[model samples]
Target: MRNIRAIANRELLSLFCSPMGYIVIAFFLALTGVFVIATRSLEPGQPATLRSVFGFMPIMLTIFAPAITMRMLSDEYRTGTIETLMTVPVSDLQVVLGKYFAAFLYYCVMVAGTLIYVLLMLIFGSPDLGSMFTSYIGLLLAGAMFLSVGLFASSLTPNQIVAWVTATIPMILFVFATNWVVSEVDSAPAIREVLQRVNIWKHMELFNRGLLMTESVAFFLATTMLFVFLTIKTVESRRWR
Candidate 1:
């Protein structure tokens, strides 16, 4: 437990110390402010809901999550530090989970900044408290799933760019591709239903409506664990090298 926390702290500090981390977060917030809040949230006489923020988050996460996680294991491999780290007392799973949680923690900080928008809504109008709380729960779960996917991608490649693209493609499919397929094609109701179920963004829609379905929570948790397990296996592969 102590080793895991140490490793997590190390990863978090690296992000806080670097310019790229802050730049990505700033750009993410800028985009969210301009495109989501400015366009829909701050309008007069509109429903005081975080629907716009939650609706826009998956797309932003598809980009931001990859950018944050791209360098985790990939940079270690690039610098030959993975070998040194592997020789330490910590186990492979600890390294992976430590880094995974670090990325998750960083994401939490970024999302926390968006809470200022919630405060803004509070002053301007009556936002549904229950729905807003559930929406944050949904975002955290979805963001964890995104971070896990990015961690798995980083475990696969030594190059950070490859890691980013690998992670982005799956998230894009989850956020956009499935929706487009269901919406554009004149498919049967059954097929569209299946596609909607597969769409990750669709799963979070319930939370925005203040409904915490067990199935949605299970889906995100199971998928996140699956990726984490895959990353552990990938990292373990290096033991033979």
Candidate 2:
């Protein structure tokens, strides 16, 4: 437990000390701000709901998750720091979780940046607090799952760009392709059913509408743990190599 905390602290410090972290935060705020303005979600006399904002979040997370996690392990490998890290008294699971926790904390800050929209809504009109609350829950869970995937991708290669791309492709499939196929194409019912079940956006739909499903929560938690374990295994594989 101590080792985990130490590792998490180290990672967090590294993130805040670097320019990339600030760049990511700025990009996130700018992108979401542009989205809200362009969609007129904050326009006067319009609905006070952030449903449109929530709807666009999966796409934002698909990009930001990889950006935040792409270097967690990959850069350690690139700089030969993994060897030094391994010599420390830490289990692979602890290392993975610690790094993941740090990334999660950073992601939370990114999510909190959206609260400005909520405040704006409160001022302009009455917002549905129930849906807003659930929507945030969904976003947190979704970001956790995506970060785990990115962590696993980072463990696979030393190239940060490669890790970023590897992490992004799966998110693109789940966030974009799944939604498009299920809603747009006249695909087979079986295929559509499968896609809907796997689609992160689909799971978020109910949360955005103030309807919370245990299934959605379970899906995100299960996916996050699955990938975190996978990343631990990937890191452990180096022992055999």
Candidate 3:
């Protein structure tokens, strides 16, 4: 536990000390702000709702989460730091969790920064606080899942570009292809059922609508854990080789 905390602290310090972290945070927040303005979500007399902001977040996360996580393991491998990191007296699981938590925390900070939008809605108009809270929770869970996927991709290669691309392709497919598949496929109930189950956007819609279902929560958590487990395995395999 102590080692994990140390590792997490180290990772967090590395992130905040670097310019890339600031760039990512700024970029994400700016993009969200632009979307909110362009969509007129905050116009005077506009209904107070964060629907526009929430609508843009999944796409933003798909891009920005990969950029944040692309270097988590890829840079270590590229610079031969992974060897020294492995020699430290920490278990692989601890290392993985520490790194994952650091990235997750960074993501949370970015999400939290967008609360300015929420505040704007609150001060200007009457909005449903319950829905807003659930939407934020959904964003956090979805971002964590995206970060886990990015970590797994980073574990696969030393090139950050490759890692970013690898992480992004799956996210894009998960967000866009599921709906396409459902629309294009011949009406096979079993196949559509499975795709809907795996469709991240579909699950996220429930949260966007302020409908908190146990199944949606479980799905994100389970997938995040699976990727984290995969990352640990990948790191352990490299240690052996």
Q: What are the TM-scores, per candidate, against the unseen true structure?
A: 0.94, 0.96, 0.97
Structural RMSD, model 1: 1.7
Overall lDDT per candidate, in order of appearance? 0.89, 0.90, 0.89
Estimate, for each residue in 134-157, the C-alpha lDDT of model 3 and write its tens digit.
898899999999999999999999
Candidate 2 residue lDDT tens string, 1-241 = 9989999999999999999999999999999899888889988878888888778888788789999999999999999999888888888988999999999999999889889999988988899899999999999999999999989999999999999999888788767877788897565888877777887878888899988899899999999999999999999999778
Among the numbered candidates, top TM-score falls to 3
lDDT of 1 by residue, 146-221 (tens): 8899999999999999999999987887678888888876758888877877677777888899989888998889
At residue 181, give the lDDT of candidate 3. Answer: 93
CA deviation > 4 Å runs, candidate 3: none
Among these predictions, the greatest lDDT belongs to 2
Q: Which stretch of 10 consecutive residues in model 3 shows the poorest summed lDDT?
A: 51-60
Please give the distance, in angstroms, between residue 235's alpha carbon in candidate 1 and its true position after superposition: 0.6
TM-score, candidate 3, is 0.97
